[model samples]
Target: MKAAAIFGPGDVRVMDIEKPEPGPGELLVEVKACGLCSSELGMWVDPNFKTDDPIFFGHEVSGNVVAAGAGVSKFAVGDRVTIFTDRGGYAEFVTVPEDWAIKLADHVPYDWALGEPIGCAMNGTSRSGIEVGDTVVLIGIGFMGGLIQQGARLKGASRIIAVDTRPESFELAQKLGADHVIDAREGNAIQRILELTGGEGADVVIEATGKQGALDMATEAVRIRGRLVIFGYHQGGKRTIDVQAWNWKGLDVINAHERDPQAYLKGIRTGMKLLEAGQLDIAPLLSHYFELKDINHAFLLAKSKPDGFLKAVITF
Candidate 1:
């Protein structure tokens, strides 16, 4: 088997590695597709964040089960599945616990089945307690941001405003069901959001950029008593926040990550059902595809963010 290992910053290599066998209550899956995530970029550039261990990267993955270990009864050999490996998904084969292996229905395409980010967005959005008829604003139109926009729409947001610096991303957000799109590079993004929400701040503001500026803006863009959900991965760091403003507005801050098993399961079931029913369309979000051999190119493209590049998948 071949796998890509990240030893440290600016260090990644493809090498022959032994295929892992399923352990108790685990399933051995032959990976079919995996999407590159933006968080990997941080891991590549930061030395302190670097890992000495040869970590097999990738979490959003879809594949087929080749074998199951003892105590695995929900699935059998040859069952198509998607997994949130958390790590070790960038390999030809990944051994994952049965609990994380989600069996895909026959109708879902393997390409779209690898949409674990959707589950992440779902978990975060649910945590925000976005109610129908609320005005929602999402800052950032990356993969998670796009999914957040769609999820907000599905949750019955009366007005969905998507904020991003890229024009292409703003347009993509509109296509993804955002009622309004704002280019944050322009001046007065917060003012524009307020105007869109008719003078009142948004009922819910989701910060998906993980940038310090975006975090500050999220806090400023929400209405009094509104909720602010930080959905993106912010590599452990400290950021200054206006505690007085947060206290004055009585705002609720929620930090979301894909850690809860029950939430992951519920999100997968809901997202899969939406995809199967054609209520949610992610085809436009997939910008490029690459073979596993061209994994390096895939990483480069993800880093470049070239025109029309939203999500890139390495397929087997």
Candidate 2:
């Protein structure tokens, strides 16, 4: 089997590795598409984050089951599914625990069936406590933020304000049901959000950029007693928060990232259900594709994030 491993910063090479077999209660999947996640960018771009040993890093995987191990009765050899794996997904073959696999509808596209991040979006929006007629403000309209916007709309938010620095993100944000899109580069994002909400600020504010600037704006964008959802994967350093404001506002702050495997499994199942029911559309979000051999190029493009780059998928 062929797989990708990072030798160092900006160096990901495809090399031959022995194909993995399904262990007890596992399923061996022939990889079809694996997503390039933003969380892995640290290892790909920064030398300080590199490790002594590098294993396969891609984890958002969707493919066909080629072999089923003992005690794996939930899936068969030919079932099309998306799986959750600790690692080793950037390969021709990878094994998945039976409980971590979710069946995908035949209509779902392989490239768009990225279960992990979609599951993260589901968990994030669910944790936001969005209700009907609530005003929701989303900071950072990237891939995770965009998915959260759609989920917020589906959850019956009356008004959705999308904020981002990139001009290219505005169109797609509106297309995904944002009532208003604010360019953070203008230095008036908080003011615009306040004006739109009649000075009360939003009922729910989600910070998905993982940058300190976005986090500061999110703290100010929510209503006095509103919910503040942190959905971003903040990496590389420490973050400071306004403890005094949080104390005064009585905000219900939620760190929306899930750690438990069962929680992720539940979210993944819900996301897949939404996709199958046509309530969620991920096709527009999967904007780039590359083969396994070009994984380095894919990582560079993902890091630089050129125009129209929502997400990158490595296809077999």
Candidate 3:
């Protein structure tokens, strides 16, 4: 089978490799689609990210079960499923534990079945403790932030404020149910939110942009004693935070990334419910697609994020 492997920064190549088999309580899935995250962009370029040459990557996946190992009973060979953490989703085939694959809804398309991120967003929403009349501020209107906006709106957030530098993001955020949009590049994002919230700041502030500056802005934008949710993938590198402000404000800071499989599965189910119930629509977010052979190009596009590039995915 042919699989795309990352040799190093900006050097990805497709190679003919032996397909992996399912071990006990695992399933061999023929991947149909996979989504790329921003973290991969850093991995593709940053030399400090030590790894074996041509590392197996791409965790966001949706596929059909081709083979099941011993002790696998919940799924069969023909089940159409979206994988949570099945390894090497960039390839044509990936082997994951039986519990990692969730059966997809009949109406869900294969491409849109990349549900791990969605589940993570759902988990963020749940951990956020967003109330019916809460004023929510989400900094960085990317894919995860947009979905969180939808989730906040669905939860009856009185005001959903979106902040992004891109003009297109404002339009998309409004369409996704944000009540207010702030151009981060225009001026002080913290000031605008403070003004919008009448100097009290928001009830819940989420930093979905992993950038340190954005995180600083979120800390300033959150109200005293309000919850601040960190929903972005801050994979590596250490950064400083304003410990004095945190101590003074009495802010409830929460790291909303879900590491447990059971937590992810629960969020996946909730995300599926939102999709089925019409509360969350991901059609607009999937802005680019590429074939397996064009995997390197896809990564480039995702990294550069040219105009109108909301997200990209690889299709089998």
On TM-score, the candidate that comes out on top is 2
Q: Give the Å error, residue 210, model 2.
A: 0.0
Off by over 4 Å in 1: 48-53
Q: TM-score for every candidate vs. truth?
A: 0.93, 0.98, 0.94
Model 2 lDDT tens row, 88-205: 7899998999899999999998887899999989998999999999999998887888889989998899999999988668977988878899999899999999999999899999
1-316: candidate 1 lDDT, tens digit per residue = 9888878766777779899989999999999988887778777666676676787888888999999999998989999988877657778999999888788888888888865777777777778789999999999987778777888888888988888898778878978878888888887899998887777799999999888999899988999999988886876588888889999999998887766677887787777778878876778888899876777777777777888889988788
Which of the two, 1 or 3, has more lDDT?
A: 3
Which candidate order results from sorting by TM-score in descending order? 2, 3, 1
Tell me how far the alpha carbon of residue 44 in candidate 3 is from the true structure, in angstroms, after superposition: 0.3
Candidate 3 — which pairs collide?
none
Lowest lDDT sum, 10 consecutive residues, model 1, at: 44-53
In candidate 2, which residue pairs clash?
none
- Total colliding residue pairs, candidate 2: 0
User: Largest lDDT belongs to which candidate?
Assistant: 2
